[model samples]
Target: MKKLFLSCLFLLFFAVAQAVPAKSFYFTTSDSVKLYVRIAGEGKPCLFVHGGPGSWPKIYYALGGDVTEQDMTMIYLDQRGSGRSGGDDKTDYSLNRMVKDFEELREHLGYSKWLVMAHSFGGTQATEYAYQHPASINGVILVASTLHLKSSLESYIVEGARILNKPESEFRKEGASVGETLGKVVSQLNEQDLMYKVMYPKKEMFAQMNAVMDTTLNWHFGSKVWDLHEYEQDFTQKSASVKVPVLVVAGKYDYSVGPQHYRLFKFPKATYKTMATGHCPYQEQPEEFGKYVRKFVARLN
Candidate 1:
């Protein structure tokens, strides 16, 4: 009995020793904005750029916690002014500023080159980063991303109409009748409305939606930079210039940044795949999403 108890204690200690905690740190941006960074998992470095010009990094955690099992050193970064990162309402949340933050973060982390994984609006930022510093990127992964913000916003309006059970023509007429700007409509959308009412309506996905909403809505300046950038942006030539290995995972039911629009990207080394869900495919179908992600990164390895 004494021997057995000692053996059990030894095994338990071994198990506890094997568990690794994530490494957390904060890095200050050029403008002195301190951003939160979480380095989890082991193996090759893979930096995750989350969406929402203002969305936090936790949304990706809600989607799929870590890709460690796929042999990746997952770097989850909460962009400046979002999540645990420090930022004020008056801070410069411009697109170029955001891109520079990522570049600086990479250098600060001591990574020569790493795979960039982006989702939703993050895709645009990641693409821009790669375009500006192609040599610093090993590969690019775009999930439900868009090249043109204005066009993508317009697509969502069309999609929102369909989800509302109204004809496309009628929806457009109503928009004109009410004079509702695209930014006005989009800024008001919560995860509950976008996930349950429109896209993934199942009860199973509701919790995931809640997780996303809770974290995303905490960002004090939600969509403020997004709307401003879209109002004065076009990326046709810039997007085409991304010569790095690109993998775009789009959602079939995504109305916001429709899969069709992603198809318009002319990245010379790009490969596209449409997942079987809506805007938040990573959150909706994490298992399959991880599978595709693993395969894509495996090639880079």
Candidate 2:
């Protein structure tokens, strides 16, 4: 009886979801990897590149991330081997290939150009995408991005160690890789139940993040991206060569990517802001985020 009732509820939910006037579908990349993409809203087109290397765009969009939709068409793409997306048999996750996927999607959609907004680790991919395919993008927006993962990992050791009341030297590198050191320190913070301190302001709100992100998703990009030598380059240095107009948002309390890391960026036509929130200023401080985003986007139109 209860099983039947639950099944009915699930069907009803699916029915309602289908009823909504939403557009979502899958696209096959040149490498034969299938990826999921959802297009909605109006005005200028803007692609959203999510973080976690493997993270999906759903949580952010679920958490009122659609605020930018008012001013632009939102293209929420789940990167290959990510949320609701299929993987490549060749196991290719190269930076150039990733950017090529974005370009191919643009050409597939028949768009001359679009804007791109990247978050956290996705910023690495977005930065590369903008540099290699500037002709296909009108502008780029980076939120709480880490151009240098090494810098971000060190931040986790320092800030997370401080929160756990552990000495940073305990996790310091002794010929170990930066990625390994980061894993050790971040594990400590998560074990102590102090991860919120490393990325959020409070436990309750942080719980909301976990509630939306579940274990059923694929995490291939996050699992393999760190070891990729191509991503290890200091994208901040390359920032100076990127001519795309940029909007950069940094957090005052975001130790995950280093709160003040934006200082290292050198995008020539960039507008910068430092929010009092943590790594997720878009969710924590949406109005302020929307204001600058809308203003910047308006200028592009």
Candidate 3:
């Protein structure tokens, strides 16, 4: 019995010592919805907000890992109703609610001030958040993000269609008519449609898009069509109030969000760069992307 007790004690200690830290946790929103968060590394805090108001935070794991290695405590948070977050409340997925969720998470983590790196739709959230809570943020990074929704989206679709080598006659005809009908046409296309084929050439990209689209559509709070008119006034009015350093990253081939939208942000303290890839620059060129981010953060230090 003594030997067995000693053996059990030893095993318990071994298990405790070998256990990987709890790198993730779930927190409740003010509305009582549960949200998931993953955190790693240790140093200056940097949170990576994902694109697609409904997309899971895991999409940034690779990039977060790279950033964390440089002594940055990287955080990836799934928006309400995405990934492991608990809530069937589609009605609670609005942009404002999402921003509240971000603020709550920041407070929960006890981060007095931290850097924010947001991608695509996540950029939209980060921009709005920065506008509202500039004092809480140390810096902001926008990746392939846009502000002028209608015009920028139109340009993105037309350019994307052209790159697919669709017949020029179809292009010329559609280009002229796209402004009025592009949203309808895009809505009709599903995860397996040819539109995605043109936009995402890689097999992995299709898988990623499908996952993101599933979550986005599942928890969409408002009209299927993104209405910038509702938020445009607020966005512009609040954006001018931002006083922190900002970095806007674009990809040359990013026909999805396009480059024109970046110009709309008139931050007095903003730096913009265009990469040689598409919507997802970090995945397309992780090493270069990581280097650029590190250099930017170094400047802040």
Candidate 4:
């Protein structure tokens, strides 16, 4: 009886595993950190690098699901210390180390050239990776990503306050009253509150940010090192060296990166698309987002 029950359990496990199309594995980095990776579909390979210095790739699943339906294989990875990946040393979150993790993952998966897709902070990561290993990247897709951090933050504060119908000076005054910078004051507010007031500013987009906020908030605050420390390298000069096919999708009202900051990159082969959403266009406007991706990938072929 015991043997029969064990056999049935084994069969159930196998069936469930087979039911899911995605194949998941652990890719160990040079520092021995085992990061989680998920691969689905089959065709041209494309990787999705999620935002949030500490965010996991799982949040991209909503968009990944749609991408998989197209003619491309989707790879999702939880950067070291973020998702199912193993990480005891937060110091490993440095830019070089993070880039190394991505490079090693691509080598481990046996892909020579793959399209890189990044959102928010992941945009910085994608650029770093492409700059370092140009031979390994076929194209890049940046969604509301920024190349200049300080400028982006400043724009967010100025434009964000304006959208909220609150003067930037007023926000500065409030922050000063609390002995904090305006940016710090803005950071303290929850995603929904901030999105409703300044970031998205539209009722529809604001409502859609809830799930994204819930997931990212948990990931963002979970880290101590990468979350607080500044990235070691500034790739402003290296950014100009990126000649890969680039597709930038920006949110017209995204307070995070500021729409104007999109001009910072000078990719030789580049295409730009503006959406009527906030930071997470894939979540707020999935259909349009998918269309943009499909068209970009198609043009590359």
Winner by lDDT = 2
- For residues 1-301, could you state the per-residue lDDT of candidate 2 as single tens digits? 9999999999999887544354999999988888899987777999999998789998677776778877788899999878888874356888888888999999999999999999998888899898888899999999899998888878877897788787878887689887778788878877878889888886766887788896788777777776788888889998898998999988899999999788999999999988898888878888898898999998885
Q: Estimate each model's TM-score.
A: 0.83, 0.91, 0.76, 0.80
Clashing pairs in 3: none
Candidate 3 worst ten-residue window by lDDT: 216-225
Q: Please report the candidate that would top TM-score against the real structure.
A: 2
* Regions of candidate 1 where Cα sits further than 4 Å from its true position: 1-18, 168-197, 201-203, 215-218, 221-223, 230-232
Question: Looking at candidate 4, what is the lDDT of residue 244?
Answer: 89
Clashes of each: 0, 0, 0, 0
Off by over 4 Å in 4: 1-20, 63-65, 170-184, 187-194, 201-209, 212-236
For residue 144, what is the lDDT in candidate 4?
86
After superposition on all C-alphas, the RMSD of every candidate to the true structure, in Å, is 3.9, 7.5, 6.2, 7.2
The residue pairs found clashing in candidate 4 are none
Worst 10 residues of 1 by lDDT: 175-184
Query: 1-301 in candidate 1: lDDT tens per residue?
Result: 9999999999999887666678899898889988889987766788888877677777776566454334678899888777788777778877778888888988998999999988787877788889889999989988888777777877777666655555556445442622254434443444326434334535467566565565434375454664454423656457788888898888887776765878778888988889878777767777888788788888984
What would the per-residue lDDT of candidate 3 be over residues 237-288, giving only the tens digit for each residue? 4556778988888877676666566767877688888787667777667777
- Identify the superior model by TM-score, candidate 2 or candidate 3: 2
Backbone clash total for model 4 is 0
